[model samples]
Each structure stands twice: as structure tokens, then as C-alpha cells.
Target: MLFGKKKEKVHFNPGNRDDGVDENFVEETVNKIDEDDVEVVLKNEENIDKKFSGNNSLSKYMELGRIMVSMLKDVKNGRYKNIPWFTIATVVMALLYVLNPMDIVPDFIPGVGYIDDVAVLTMGVGWIESDLHRYLDWRLENDLGI
Candidate 1:
């Protein structure tokens, strides 16, 4: 404790009642975003690698990113058709949010920039946990890497 202020632990509130996430807005944002955009993002894992490099402090969001990567890969290859459009939209929206540096908090803050991103992601993935876990397990079972 010699040189700087202790960073406040940014708590993520995933809501108690209905998780407090505005699903409609998330869906609309996803719907408005071009599928090409999502594809572009999904296609460029280097971009994802770069984005993840900038903020390693938030693993939860990164985990979400991994989930999205799996989903995106499946969708791109025509191997999985069971993903609902809403889920796809939400995952794409989270990826877009992470790539944006000037979100609810600017990424230049050094210590607090990615808090909102983490919160957004934690909430975004709340409803999709089962699907993600299933996909993750399937990947494990099938020895898929991406």
C-alpha cells in the first residue's frame, strides 16, 4: 500500500427478480446490426485476441467471448442450427460492446474501464448458460478447438 489508491471492487448485479437485463433492447440492437458485421467479427479471431489482450482482468467476459466464439463457429460452418436468433443476437451484441472502447466506461481508465463490459456480459450470458455449457461440453467431447 505505498503508491496508489486501492481499486474499488466493481460489483456486478445480475438482478434478483428477472435479472434486470433489457432483453428487448439487446435483441433490437442485435437485429439492427448486420449479420455481416457479426460474421466479420467472428471470422477475425485475431481481432478477438487483440480485444481480449487489452483487458485480461475480466475473465468472465472473456469466458462469454469464448462461448460466442463456439456459437459463431458452429453457425458459420452450418453445423448447428438450434441456436435461437435472439441468443445469436445477444452474443453478437456482447462482442460488439467489448470491441468498443468508449462504452459506459472508457477503456483508458486503467483500472475501471472494463467493469461495465463485464457486467453487461455477465448479464448477457445469464440466460444462455445451459446452451453454452452444452456447447462447451460438446466441444470437449469432440476435441474441437477454436
Candidate 2:
């Protein structure tokens, strides 16, 4: 019973929860994203930056967001075709998830609202981390300045 209590506590912790955003939901949303969605993210770049720059757990992933945005822009302009469609979609999904206020955890909640966002962003970054590094290298080689 003591061990069960410990397990329950850990399960409830946002940082350790396994019931975060669903992969199917992410895939469905990502599939629907188009040029307009990309435009929305680009237009709200400053807002996104502000969200990530805030003093929270999500702040650490700010660089990841920046890399994703840069990759999205390049892909949009056809300057980066080396990335797979799934990677592009995953990045878009993550960015859009941040922009959405009514996600798995509503952003209005104090102290814990961004937990799910961070989880989603983390998952997306994990899925595309290698591609992101490759993109950065490409940028450097081409003088694109990552």
C-alpha cells in the first residue's frame, strides 16, 4: 500500500504523467495544417517568443521553438526540402499547440497550465531533434545563420 501511494503521487505529477496530449490528436491536427496555419504561426512569432521567454518550465525549450520556427519558414519558402513531411508536421503541431490556449491543460490555470504544453513541445522536439540539428548544420554551411 505504501508503494502504491508513492506510485499514485508520481503519476499525478504533471512532469511525469503519461496521459498528456494524445498522439492521434497531434497527428490529426498536424495533418490539417496548411500554408495559412504556417502564416498564423509566423504572424504570432513574437507572442510565441514571449510565451517561451517567460519564467516557467517551458522557457528551457525556447531554443527548440526558435529552431522549429526557422525550419518551418525554410520549408514554407521551399528553401529546406531535405526535411521529411512528418518532421515538418510535427514542428507545426508543437507550435500550434503552444498558440492554443484551450489545450489539454488550459493556459489560464495558474502555476500548472503550461505543463501539458511543455510535454507536447518536448515530445515534438524529441521526434525531430536530429532533423533540427541537421537543419542547423545546413544553415551554417549555407550561411543562413541558425
Candidate 3:
């Protein structure tokens, strides 16, 4: 302490609510998703789009979900293979989370219900942004429009 400044305690605050959808939860859920789950998400694409259509901000995240679905489909069909498995799983998890009505904040709730869904999608995008960009680049190179 003689030549250095006094140490100050630092408190960490995540600023997150009590919603059960944290990083660890997302990771666990992502790990559990398989090809079948991705298919389920694909089948329910209409519902997912409808659910997020009314709001502009939510619509953006919805589009991200759609892009993820396309990437997943391409990967499954062997059309695209540049993405990592973790990225694929994260996308599936985000889509599944949006499709579920009984998530941390039930979709049926008014106003703030989709907040957690958006958060999950945002987190997923953050985790796989580079991979996503590479996929997009591949799509452009192949003339497969997004």
C-alpha cells in the first residue's frame, strides 16, 4: 500500500431480471437441440413470423431468426458447411425460444412478453456474428439472396 493507490471494491451488476434465460441456460438449451428440433422450428416458421410481425423492433429480430433458419436448412442439406456447430445450435435455441409461448416471460403476457425472446436472439447473434457474416458472404458468392 505504500507506493500504490488504495484498492477500491468493485461491485458487479448484470442488470438482468430474474428471468431464467441467462447465458448458462441458453448454452444448456442450445446443447439439447437436435436436427429434429430444428425441423420443428422450421415447421413453425409461420407462427414465429406472425408473433413478431406487429412490432418493428421485434420484426428485426424476427428477420434474424429467418436468416438463421435459412442457414440451418442450407447446412442440413449440405449446401453450406462454413458455419460451426455451436452457431447452428445457438440459432436453433433462439428460434425454439421464440416459438415457445411458455418461455421465461410467457408470450401471452402483454407488452413485455417478447423481451426475453428478443434478448435470446440478440445473444445468439452476438455469439455467432462472425459465422453469420461468413454464411452471408457465402450466400452472396453463390448468388443465393438473403
lDDT, each prediction: 0.64, 0.73, 0.74
lDDT of 2 by residue, 53-101 (tens): 8775566778778888888788767788787666766777788889899
How high is the lDDT of residue 79 in model 3? 89
Q: Please state the error at residue 4 of candidate 2 in Å.
A: 54
Ranking by TM-score: 3, 2, 1
Error of 3 at 93 (Å): 0.7
lDDT of 1: 0.64
RMSD of each: 12.5, 12.4, 12.4
Clashes of each: 0, 0, 0
Candidate 3 local lDDT, residue 106? 94
How far residue 20's Cα lies from its native spot in candidate 3, in Å, is: 12
Model 2's TM-score against the true structure:
0.76
TM-score of each: 0.74, 0.76, 0.79
Name the top lDDT candidate.
Answer: 3
Better of 2 and 3 by lDDT: 3
